[model samples]
Target: MLGDSAYKLALETKRTQAHLPMYNEALVHHLCRETRHIMGELETLLQSLETIRDEPDADTRSVAAQLAVKHATVKRNKRCLLAYQAQRLRFLQNVFWQVGGVPEEIKPQLSPAELDFFSGYALAVNTYKAPFIDLDLTVSDLPPKDLYIEVRVLQDCGEVQLENGSLLLSKNSQHHVKRTDVDHLVSRGLLQHIDG
Candidate 1:
């Protein structure tokens, strides 16, 4: 079953068709088919790795080295396939993507502040393709702590506060953000370093 956020996103996507390439539906269809194939291949590679891991009779050391190399190769290929799919989505939908979802194959540039903001804010976001202008506008103020918790179930923790207000959670906390996500959020002026 879809989560509430996913269900809402599905509805919004149906209403707006922001991610579909209707102009070239045929092309997008083909791309989607190919993307599914690539994903299946990636899954197979992962399963192969698991098989090698479970092969008690096989040379575990050689299998470990092979699995690492296979994993990297799978990652690189999956990235390329994803980029292609994203480009195809852009072409089909003719809708603008968020600054962060511009397909890394296009450019990897993101400012430091945006990095911080995206990093911090990513912890609270659901889908990147949602109508973000409204929600994105609220980054400066941010959702209340409990509300953020409601929206993000799998997101990393961005801001944390201790039970006491003396020391910052960042000081004693191990919570961290990815550099890209940090750039994505901070550039938009969404994250503020606050005293806890």
Candidate 2:
């Protein structure tokens, strides 16, 4: 699903075209495909390790060294995959921000890598300040007022305080809340926005 979304977005981006300097669409596709490939490899490695672990002690001794090597490979690849995803997220964030603005629900859910990339992006754009024209308009703008949103909670969110009252978001529960209050939750992936 993620791979399909990434590819679709890339194709749409290339077809529509960008009027300003932005992240490369084709590169996004490549990174997404690479991440998916690494994830598949990691899954296979983990399953193999599980199989080895389930064997009897006597049988496992012979391949203990091999299992250790495979474990290390899996760890390394997992880190690589995370980094690639972070990079991809950063690019997408910028792309969406530039065109209109990153939806409020996505801003706070940025991973460490994506946050770091955002920091660098912020600094780079800040340096381009204009003396008269004020060319520093890179930051994303805010959404409109009065939005009605429906979200399905992916995990327990404890109690969230709102202006009107507090609500507990239980796992797998669906609720209607204002976008302002739940945007952060959605960005954290704790809640999935369900469009009517």
Candidate 3:
């Protein structure tokens, strides 16, 4: 039993280490896809607005104005996504550093925003005399979740073996679980919280 437990720990550690790279890549890809989709929708709206703006009808003019607002909103959303992507990449970089550097091929190219984030992170850690640089600046101030909720899995998560039984998270699978139990998966876009 002891040997079995030891082997499980070792295997779980290995999976955790390997999962980071996959998670990081998945995050970047998701962000990029969302940004591109928003940009495409914005472009289409702009193109349609151009025609409406040239029309003499007042209704068309109002439509154009609405499209303009939508365009601006999409631009703002894209910027927010970009900012989030940078922050998330920086956080992953710190995590990689904490456990030793990631594999060269899997390492993402650092952006100026990421570099700036790291600079600020280092400064804050130094100023506070932090023992190790493993702080997750994102969502650090959020309140704890006390409610359990239902979530739908968007991807296969393999078999999560727990103390009593194992949970199978195949694609499109739904499960009722605590927020803390699926927080990481939701953050990684693998699971989605279903509002009741």
lDDT by residue for model 3 (1-196), tens:
2123223333433455433333334444554565566567768877777776667863565656666765665565455455545445655565534433333544454554554665676566555656645444332247765557788989899987533467889999898876655666676668888887
Q: Please identify model 1 stretches exceeding 4 Å from their true place.
A: 1-22, 56-196
The sequence of per-residue lDDT tens digits that candidate 1 reaches over residues 1-196 is 2122223333433543334322333433444455455566657766776787776776566645655654554454445445544444443222122343333432233334333444455443445526564344323233344312211113334454432332122322332332223333433334432323
Clash counts for all predictions: 22, 0, 0
Off by over 4 Å in 2: 1-146
TM-scores of all predicted structures: 0.23, 0.33, 0.33
Select the stronger candidate by lDDT from 1 and 2. Answer: 2
The model with the greatest lDDT is 2
Ranking of all candidate structures by their lDDT, best first: 2, 3, 1
lDDT of 3: 0.57
